[model samples]
Target chain A: MSFQPVKFYQTGTFTVGNRLLPPEERSVQAQTKRFNSINSGHRACQGCGEALGARYAVDAAMEAANGQLICANATGCLEVFSTPYPETSWQVPWIHSLFGNTAAVATGIAAALKVKQLKGERRDIRVVAQGGDGGTTDIGFGCLSGMFERNDDVLYICYDNGGYMNTGIQRSSATPPAARTATTLAVGDEPGNLFGQGKFVPAIAMAHEIPYVATATVADLRDLEAKVRRAMAIRGARYLHILVPCPLGWGTASHETIRIARLAKETGIFPVFEAEHGELKSVLAIRRPLPVEDYLKPQKRYAHLFAPKARLEVIARLQQLADRNIRRYGLLEGN
Target chain B: MLKQIEGSRAVAEAVALCRPEVICAYPISPQTHIVEALGEFVKDGTLAPCEFINVESEFAAMSVAIGSSAAGARTYTATASQGLLFMAEAVYNASGLGLPIVMTVANRAIGAPINIWNDHSDALSQRDSGWLQIFAETNQEALDLHIQAFRLAEELSLPIMVCMDGFILTHAYERVDMPTQAQVDAYLPKYEPRQVLDPAEPVSIGAMVGPEAFMEVRYLAHAKQMEALKLIPGYAAEFREVFGRDSGGLTHTYKADDAETMVVAMGSLLGTIKDVIDEMRAAGHKIGVLGITLFRPFPIAQVREALHGAQRVVVLEKSLAVGLGGILATNVRMALSALPIDVYTVVAGIGGRPITMRSLHALFREAERDDIDPVTFLDLNHDVVDKQLARERSTRRSGPAAEAILRDIGVVAAKVAQEVR
Candidate 1:
């Protein structure tokens, strides 16, 4: 991920303080007039990566669509916290159908807008569907795949927090290998989540050969916003998967959300990249590659592997998976 | 505009005439032909400005309809049996969100034995799903109800399921008075959504309602249906003014004005029941039939009024409540709870068992004599059932009962029955 450097200031870094750069080049969140799509005074936890990710992605989509946007949200932490009955945190046209039908709902909204547009009754109104990993990868997988296959005009954003954090951190299809969840307990010969169990939905989304597919993290707001803007620019099915860590679920510090996401990308465990119509387009190169332990050690879900005996073999296996991702996406500089 | 066509095609044409803006389809048995025709209509520009979405599953089909409908597009979809059950969650969501989406439920029996035949189990299972359910007695009624469905749904901001018997009505070829586009246009005006997903006036729908207001939110859904109970008759009358036919209402009565024995049923089975009633009336047995059109909202007052004059009412339904004999009969009993009328529950045509005129004549005669059982499974093969029950009692592992029954009947006999059909 590259941007033109502002000569006099340190604007090339991933921080939001790029005020010296031209207004158009600055991130949507940096703008004072950015659409606070997911507004304040909600129930999202402290340092909630999903909350940050949703705001960044939706605000960018709102900007890209010129405020002509409707969002269909899947039932998750995002929906539960944002809208509690008579009170709503969303300022834009939004709907939360069910946990597994957000993509299809977005497709319906897009289709409706298109028909209305054709009838000369409405203008260019784009749609975005969003959900958590549980909704996107497990229960909602069929609808997501259908939306992709039909090439429906929907930008589906999956806030991947690795488990069903909203429901007490149960195992989801996106839960990492050997990561403890309520359902996948750290016990027996193989503790935590079983190896080769969970799925990588971004790869599945890419397999659908959609118009756009991208993976981002809260650590890189610029990349996340840019990807969302790029997706909104496309007409057909597009997917943006963001690694949003959960403090309560991951057993990490409330303030470690961004740092953990940064470590995830830097360790090659979660390669931040973008793809266009099934072909790899660009990779966010790791400036300083770190070991998988640097990413996992802070989270108590993985504390079992470090405590009591320090399972070196398990750590080695997790490292191998990270190394595989690095080789697959060529994440490290000059790799 | 009268043509002899398959029931599904007539329905497809009727649905198209309503000018749905979005049609989400997932192929399920019986309802497949209707969507297939609608698909072609969209493909060939017959249904212009309409998006035909072939979704992955019944859940997506309903979910997509929910989205389009909430966005203020007149949306439609169809499913049956397992398909209906598969999309049960979304079905409730669409209604709970108050999206006025119309759907066709090609009524079929639910499975364990896995039969794909016509029954009322599918729609009856969703009786409390906060959607208006209207049963069609004939293919023409099925065709006519869909147009009224859109109008009624949009008018009240409620989802409706126009249930027609699968394979029986969906596959049957019949003459239907297909309404013209001009007539349908005059009848069902352009959809003006009550609440919509528009950027111009943004609103967050499907919010998480807590216990404090969840009951009120649910009560509103019930209120809407109660409101629908009043509005359905007017819509049907207006429909008649345009299309010149009486198609949909709470219930329709045939010869029940001064009759003693009243036979009550719904869907395609009404045609059969009505025919039996006609013969019994001619024989001076003073029998009549009540065809329940709107099953949901139960039409409690109307049902009580209609059956109040009768000495006894035999409720023949195509669905059973398994452990509790009759689904429709239970509701009918509730409707006539204050009256002294003996309501006999006759569960018939279950899993597509043939409800022959011969069997019905005997059943009606028995009911007239007040000698019928409280709950009767019409045309049940008692010998085979008894043999299976005996086998289960004697053997530790009694294999699958459905297969055992099939074997007891003999494969050759089953083959002969299939050939006869």
Candidate 2:
């Protein structure tokens, strides 16, 4: 301990108290007029990943579009939590569409904007649709693909926190291997979320060869915001998959939200990269690739993989998967 | 001016006349003609300043409507049967998010036996989706309802579904007093969204809500539906003054005065029920009819007052409650429970089976029967029982007789037991 002083100071200790943290240092969501793009008061869990992802992503999109962003949210945790009955936490123009339909909704919004422009309204509006992995990769997959094929002027974002954190933390196609969810339990030989299952939506998105495609994590605030700014610069069906860790569902510390997200990327399990039309443009390379177990041990979802000789086979398989991703995307130098 | 028009075409023409900013839809049976017409209008520039989005599926159709509506654009769409089921999640979202989207529900029965016909089951399934649902009795009503639906939806900032009987209304041709563009302009004001996508005022529309505030938000939506009771009449009165035509705005009262028995119905079935009522009255049966145009708001007060004098009320519905009874009958029971009215429920026309004039006469006869149950599932094939008994006995004792019988019978024989219940 470097005598950094066991400083036991409670900085403002409450909701609006963040004001004491100098305006710049305050959390983006803590600001009074901070876009509130994902405004206050929703039905999200104590630490829902989708909630954090929406706030970070939408606020960033709002900033990119100069606050002229219209969002189409697929029916899921975000939609349920935000607009329950009569009241809503959304401060911006937001639409809650069916699950598996955000891509088409955004496409329509873009078409409407084009019409506005033809009518000489000169509205430089941007469209964004959001959904969880289940909605993006499964139910709404056809619509999403259609949007990509049509090159609709919309930026479709998927907030992938592994599985469907809503509806009781069920397993989704995006759920990783050896992760135990409500539907995918750690039973059977080679238990938990089975290997050779799930989808790499970002890779699939890149294959469409649209203008922009990126994979991000909530760990890096500035990076996430910057990517949103970059995605808005293009005008076609763009894709952004954000890895937002759900503390409540993932059984992690609420305060460890950013740290866990960082470890996910650093472990090479969830590669952070950008692509344009099937070609990898840039990668947020890990400085020092850590063992996959270092990341898995922190979350309780992977707790079962840790018992009995540390399940080196499972850890090795995960590391092999990560290594494959690194090699495939040239996630580091010397590709 | 009256012109020959299919129910779907009339709905399409009315939607064009309404001049919505965004029209998003997916093709499904029965509703396909409606969306196709709108798409043609968009392609030909007849529907100017509109974005016609051909979505991937019905789910996407509703999804796109939600987005366009939130973007401060007047949005419209149409779907039916399986398409409606596919879009159910989006339907609930549009209402929950409070985006005033207007959708045309070409009501049809959901299928497992694979059906495509006229029924209220499709639209009735979404009765509690927080949308303002209006049932049309005719093609003319279907057209007029589309225009009125936009006004009502915008007024409450709630999504609205204009339901028309599949094939019965969508495929049938009828003469309708189609409103002129100018007339519609005067009646249905240009959609100016109260909450819009603006950069200067930067606000989020669908932010995640926690458990602490979720229930309150739903309660507010429920409160809005209740508030619509007052709004429907006010808007209807205004629409009547402007266009000089104001039918299909809400519940329609037929010959309810001094009647001992009244038949309450919805959608196209009303026309048949009315004819039956007239014949019953001619035969000194003391019968009347009450047609429900607005189903979602339930029209509690209006229904109570309409049936106040009636001793017995028979509700003719196209959708069944499965384990319960008739959906419309259940609402009627809840509405008039305080009064001493004997309510009878008749479920018919499911899976688009035609509710003929003769069938309705039989319903009235059943209603007058001394031993008639309060809830009766009509159009039920009585032959299913025999088929079921034979199948059950055969399956229980799988001997040579059972094998021989199975060989003689068709695929229907296998499901006879299930069909019995």
Specify the highest-TM-score model's number.
Answer: 1
- The sequence of per-residue lDDT tens digits that candidate 1 reaches over residues A1-335 is 23455554345554555655677788898788999998999999998999999999999999999999999999999999999966799999999999999999999999999999999999999999999999999999999999999999999999999999998999998999999999999998889998884489999999999999999999988889889988988889999999999999999999889889999999999999999999899999997889999999999999989988899999999999999999999887532
- After TM-score superposition, the amount by which residue A262's alpha carbon in candidate 2 deviates from its true location, in angstroms, is 6.3
Residue A63 in candidate 2 has what lDDT? 69
Model 1 residue B193 CA deviation (Å) reads 0.7
lDDT of 2 by residue, A1-335 (tens): 01222323455331123344455544555445568776678777766667887887888787678778777777777787787646677767676556777798788778767777777764788888888888898877988988997789998989888787778788888889889899888777877888875589888887888889998887766567668778988888899999989887788988777778888888888888888887888988886678888899989999888875478888898999989877877776622
Q: Compute each candidate's TM-score over C-alphas.
A: 0.97, 0.82
TM-scores for chain B, listed for all candidates: 0.98, 0.92
Least well predicted 10-residue stretch by lDDT in candidate 1 chain B: B412-421
**lDDT agreement of model 2 with the native:** 0.81
Model 2 CAPRI rating: acceptable
Clashes of 1: 0
